[model samples]
Target: MGLLRLGAAGVVLGLASMPTFGQRASAVQLPTYSYFTVGTSVSVPDRGGAWLDGVDRAGSGVQSFGSARLLGGTRAFGTGRSAAGVGITATIHDFEALEAGLVDRRVRSTNAAPAGNDAWTARLDEARVSRAGRGVPSVAAINAELGLAEQAADQEAAGWLQRGRQAEEAGKPNVAKIYYGMAARRATGSQRREILARIAGLQPSPEAGQDAKTSETRR
Candidate 1:
């Protein structure tokens, strides 16, 4: 994967990388942001470009967006891809140094239960893990702290969208789907619709495909 300089705004704990594949990612150095920016693996053509994984591939973009909440500030997920310019997104969860850089450095100013807007600042410590998190237990908090009840869902969705797109580019559609699924959960309004559509565009399971064919035959 090329460097993941590209970023979209979101509300979540401090941005940092997460380790994918139970290990740290290569040191390609994705850009740092005060908000969480998920990490992705940077890969090169394996020796002599012979490795199947090294080949660069392109993926489809989101033509639709979420329709949840219906908040005004919510921007279309990738409605204006041309304006945003194509950039890499975090694909795999295997980010390097995440365990050491972020999870290990957590600190809490107080013993509060971590509610309200303050939760949005939980701390990704995000190398996707560098945020020295605010001492909230479990990854589920990343959800509430990301301000789930509020309108920041689109912001959070964008980050996930980028990851799915980048994963697709890396010729990893299954991985992309994982991130896209995550985005789908958080996305609202047009963003959600588009992401769902994008997921549909990907290949379906054999059971689902057979069902579709059966339904078509019945029709």
Candidate 2:
């Protein structure tokens, strides 16, 4: 299983607080009811292409990203312990070779982005579930519950750009600077350069300068 079993709240409390295996129990495990985690992994073979709850081929993986399955796909699969034993098979086609007409690499090698958004969010949800004492869902199951939609980085930058423009029009240079700065972080190429130029055009507020001077005088 990709996720390790967690406590009722999906948290791993300090083991030092508990007695050793042979010792008597003194401390008790507490549940916080919240689960969260952050990490990444790259499974070289990813042999048994994941099922909903680690089963087998979930019917067919509909290409979620690229043109073909290797590029990425989404599919429905069975869940629960019944299907647990499925998809455990591993072979040559699973790794180290290209399939017939398919141009992409095999199962694991096709991991285009190491810690993609989907995987990361799934891990987070799994962590919560495990901590909540609810059984952890398989990677496939997590995908089944999630949607493919997401705001692209450029789209987010555009929103920030619009906010900055609004602030500028309202005569709030300080506020506009904050929004423009955020826009620059997600903007690319010319858009980023333009944001920086806007930043340069705005002058620091007179009140800000006086505040700095007052602090210096106090020192």
The candidate that achieves the highest lDDT relative to the unseen native structure: 2
Distance from true position, residue 184, model 1, in Å? 0.7
RMSD of each: 36.1, 36.6
The candidate that wins on TM-score is 2
Q: Number of clashing residue pairs in every model?
A: 44, 7
Q: Cα deviation in Å at residue 91, candidate 2?
A: 52
RMSD of 2: 36.6
Instruction: Specify the poorest-scoring 10-residue window by lDDT in model 2.
Output: 36-45
> Once superposed on the true structure, which residue ranges of model 2 sit more than 4 Å away at CA?
1-151, 207-219
Measured with C-alpha atoms, the lDDT of residue 82 in candidate 2 is 21
lDDT of 2 at 7: 55
- How does model 2 score by TM-score? 0.28
Q: lDDT of model 2 at residue 159?
A: 96
User: Mind giving the per-residue lDDT tens digits that candidate 2 earns over 3-97?
Assistant: 55555224433343232322432333333232222222212122333221122222322212222323132333322222223122332242212
Give the local distance difference test score of model 1. 0.49
